[model samples]
Target: MHVKYLIIGAGPTGLGAAHRLTELGEHSVLVLERNPYAGGLAASFRDAAGFTWDIGGHVVFSHYTYFDNLVDALLGGEYLEHMRIARVRIAERWVPYPFQNNIRHLPPDMQWECVQALLPGHRREVAPTNFAEWFEYVFGAGIAKYFMRPYNFKVWATPAEMMSYQWIGERVSVVNLEMVLRNLVLQLDNVSWGPNNLFRFPQQGGTGEIFTRLAARLGDKVRLNTPVAAVDPASRAVHTADGQTITYDKLLTTGPLDILIRDQIGAGPAAAMVGDGMRAAAGQLARNGVYVAGVGVNGTRDDDTCWMYFPESNAPFYRLTNFHNYSPRNAARPGHQRALMAETSWSDHKPEQLDTLMDKTIEGLVNTSMLHPDETARIASRWSIAVDYGYPVPTPGRDDALRCIQPWLEAHGIYSRGRFGGWKYEAANMDHSVMQGVEWAGRMVLGEEETTYKL
Candidate 1:
């Protein structure tokens, strides 16, 4: 099969590219997805009990007008807009998110500790090397110790010292001393911070509906359950596992750069040593796997919070999103039901018990006051999914690795873009991922310069 563009992985990135290509009046496009469904990590599934669960907590917020327009056109009136009401569970108490900004909510002594740490003139590092140093420099010692350090360690599944600080643009809320002191003095609640302060979600299905609807619009151009075994970029051909060779003028891949380099590209003559350094850098790439366990309850839930972050080790899960609160249709039972999606991270530094993960996760919810122990009787459904490529850790070496790998792939008519493809957690968000695709297609077809994919 010959096509002008052969897109790999029918997730947000691939779908976005195909959608843009078609929008530009390019018909010769084929999307090949390994899974039977589109959306990749963004996919959603309804359990046997009928509760719809997303891969993780996916909220729809955009940095680009193009992305907002795409989602609006697709979902139309089926989507729900929400004001983000997020919190953090620390010291067995609930505090408004941007923990540093809301230190007044903590006990007297703890508040003093945080305030005293900030009382000194802000300490700015001339050159902060790691995330740990960056946190200390930006948030001071107390806030860093109380919240940033432990919380980040749990979320990243790697030491804060091991990761880089470049990817933290709008993702991490920095400490605002003026606002924090004012809130403390007046005992005000400072909950508003971050770009996801307001977001949208599908009213009916989970987050996956957006992509599934997009894939449907693309129609016959999408090929599911067809995993590509290898791509001979030398001949501009992709060999499928089932013995199908697809030759393309340009190939857009959204799969993991490391996997594509090690498995598909291998040590081909186009570049023999390509596999060695890329493979070594891939091993150095700091990334953590996530285990999302969905707990469905038949009874009504009291909390109206969207999601909450847990920094302490008392809970196994780092963050929990009230799935049912996001959308009422997420409930499986007829009367009143609630669903909580808890995310647990695991890496070589932090190993997790996969077998007892569900049970432990339940215990964690109880410990964190997210679920009452007595509410266990009202449990309707329980399921867990392990996502290998959850969060791409922004290690110090990540940019260097991408700099080496991306140029090589593009030189041979292969464009790697997406969460894991680009390997940038900052731009790995839903809106950013899709725009990466849109921008990639524009660059390929219209000779436009790409912004999101720049190293």
Candidate 2:
């Protein structure tokens, strides 16, 4: 069958692109997906208790008005907007978020320990081109040495030294030396600019609901379970895993760029360059995540908080959230029966054994006192899924490699955009990812500038 565009991966990004195309009256579009459902990583799994768990924690925070406007256009009803009440869990202590900026909240000795080597004057003197250097420059030696460095390793499964700091643009805020010192003297919390400062979430369903509903708006354009197996760029034909071939004038690939290149264009100096970009990225990545481990405790209180982060090495999970508090339906019950969701991460190559990691995660919560070890709470069903490229690794030489690969793909008329598609962590949030699709459709049909793809 002939189509104007063939969009692969029925995730939010692809759906966004398709919706835009449909809205603009572009009918010759085919959206394909391997999964039976849309939403990709934004998809959620529900347990028998009516509790919904996002593949990973996704909050709708957008820098682009197009994304914000489109989501509102598709979405109806009251979406919850919560001020961020996040904290960092380190060394069994709950330090307010932007841990480096607020570590003064810790015990005096702990504060002194972090401040001693981090006098702002004696910080690392190197040029600090890598992530570790940037960490030292932003947080100083003590905080970086103690929390920022090790905790990141536990998450990305890579060392900071190997990472590049370019991707931290909007994802992480640089520490304020003056404010940090001032706050150290007087106990105070710091609020800073970040993408998800005040964000929205569905009132009932999880983030997946947004995508599913968005897909519904597309009518019959999406073809689920349509995994693209191969593509012949010469004739612009895509082969599905089921041995069906579809020809299109243009193709948008949301799968991993390196894999798509190797499969479609074959390996060579060009393929090696793309692969090197991925490897260079891996050196910086602390990839993989384990989530949806909850505790059903008795009695519910109004001690509502959004999400908490962990910077200490002792804590296995880097983040925790009071799910019930985010939306009562997240936990879906009241009274003393409380449920909490925490997330931990690992790497693909060196994954922590499922059973072993689960044990450690629970113990970690107990050890941290977030959950009392002695308290009896039935361990409800746990949800664990390994997102291969959960967080894109931004390392040095990445731009060089993307520069080489992107143009080559463009020459072949193939557009790759998304979280993993572009390998941009800063612009890889739910909203940004959706905008990537929307903007790509604009480029395809309207010949307008590529917005999300620009960065």
The candidate scoring highest on lDDT is: 1
lDDT of 1 by residue, 118-226 (tens): 7656555456899999987888788888899999888889999899998888888788778889999998987778889999999977989999999999999999999
Expressed as tens digits, the lDDT of each residue in 176-291 for candidate 2 is 67777788788777855576778788776778888888888776788888877777766677888888888888888887665666654443223343455444533332334444
Best of the candidates, TM-score: 1
What are the runs in model 1 whose C-alpha is more than 4 Å off? 121-126, 267-275
Error of model 1, residue 29, in angstroms: 0.7
What TM-score does model 2 achieve against the real structure?
Answer: 0.91
**Worst lDDT window (10 residues) for model 2?**
264-273
Please report, as a residue range, the 10-residue window in candidate 1 with the lowest summed lDDT. Answer: 267-276
